[model samples]
Target: MRSKEIVIRDVEKTFQTRGGAVQALSKVNLNIEPLSFVSVVGPSGCGKSTLMNLLAGLDTPTGGVIEIGGERVSGAQEGNAVVFQRDLLLEWRTVIANILLPFELHGVTWLDRKDRTTNRQLAEDLLRMVGLEGFGDKYPFELSGGMRQRVSICRALIQRPTLLMMDEPFGALDALTREQMMYDLLRLYDQYKCTVVFITHSIEEAVFLSDRVLVMSERPGSVVRDIKIQLERPRNLSTRMDARFLDCVKEIRGVFQSQGVLAEV
Candidate 1:
């Protein structure tokens, strides 16, 4: 369970559509320390996803550089995995099969029987790690949204990624399920020592799960504030009640407040 660091320097991105030359990011510079959990929050169309895609190597930056573990990202790297807001699980496959799909697709098992055996055991171990023990035999359609998301997280981890990039992965669920998913995510992050770059809209979620929170401006987005979350780890629901936790949330909201995007903190 090795973790990797990410470095982004002077990153900029632009889109050429009928509107012509839409700048999404400007001079974005960030360094995600190894094995740390970092969250990015901002208003809609703020390029949070754009930055994430660049880090995941799903897209290329128009300018500057993005590196993972000291190596430049040219395209989708083998050691990086991404989970989106949507579960995107294959309804036809059972949960365990879905978790192992990456290995089959990447032909990890074709390397040798040893890799196959190791990954199968890893998949089951990760399933139980997220509290999804016996549900592995069930299909995606048989699970609730939160349960499906739990499976998705396991699927991502089964690849043993060094960098796990998520784009608002929990935003679609109901409020209670979202909170439960947050707890599950924290536990998984602790267990898997991978660098996480999470994108979210909730100040509370950002403060609760992140070692640091990066706030972006409205448009042509860039990092406006990189606030360190000084709270203790192994955070549960009660952590939301901690004074420092509340202050961290408030501090991030205050950044939005100053931008006139939020009226209250």
Candidate 2:
């Protein structure tokens, strides 16, 4: 087996609010292997976003530590990329230009100026891979929510980061669109083979998308269970009908139910 790519060691995070000190995460330990897809499910205000922020170095932990590829995470590393719920595209830039934003911001002037042809080709290829080939010249407003999010995914991948962090990236889309995006993401994961740490509240989504699902308890959130999904890959809607998938959902649902966080269905 390959060595762990990301490790969170007894990690804890706290925030000081007007009310008092807020404990966001407590003793959260995780080991994510390379090229694996993991989803974290938790209740609202259960520190799911906080955990992502810590990993991204957007915020520092009050205690413990997080390591990426054996290096302590002080700030965002070059090997990681993040896609948030919102597309966060530059409204003024065309789709292809938006996909090229990271390389430009990183000051790769060679790619930015004299030899932009290669970068442009790469952007075109990525847009095509994400089903936005002909739409590359279109502005963000011209695309649908799913199409815009596909562009966002392309932008995240443009850097070819080893670790990808997605925080409720499909939460804003409608149910059908979200499901389609899930399949698209899986296809992308198959191609890139990058480690993914996905954050979401939906039990069904978590079960469908993860190699492992970590269930978190309420505020002062902690990992209550880490369930490895043994479902076959190249998963589609049919996988959801399998007994194993249903069992996994039921088991995860039980975890949330025990914590009084299961969504009323």
Top model by TM-score, which number?
A: 2
Clashing pairs in 1: none
lDDT of 2: 0.90
Show how many residue pairs clash in every candidate, following the order shown. Answer: 0, 0
- lDDT of model 2, residue 14: 89
Worst 10 residues of 1 by lDDT: 106-115
* Per-model TM against the reference: 0.95, 0.95
Prediction RMSDs, each to the true structure? 1.8, 2.1
* lDDT, candidates in the order shown: 0.90, 0.90
Residue 13 in model 2: lDDT: 94
Off-target runs (Cα >4 Å) in candidate 2 are 1-4, 110-114, 263-265
Q: What stretches of model 1 exceed 4 Å from their correct place? A: 109-117
Error of 1 at 127 (Å): 1.5
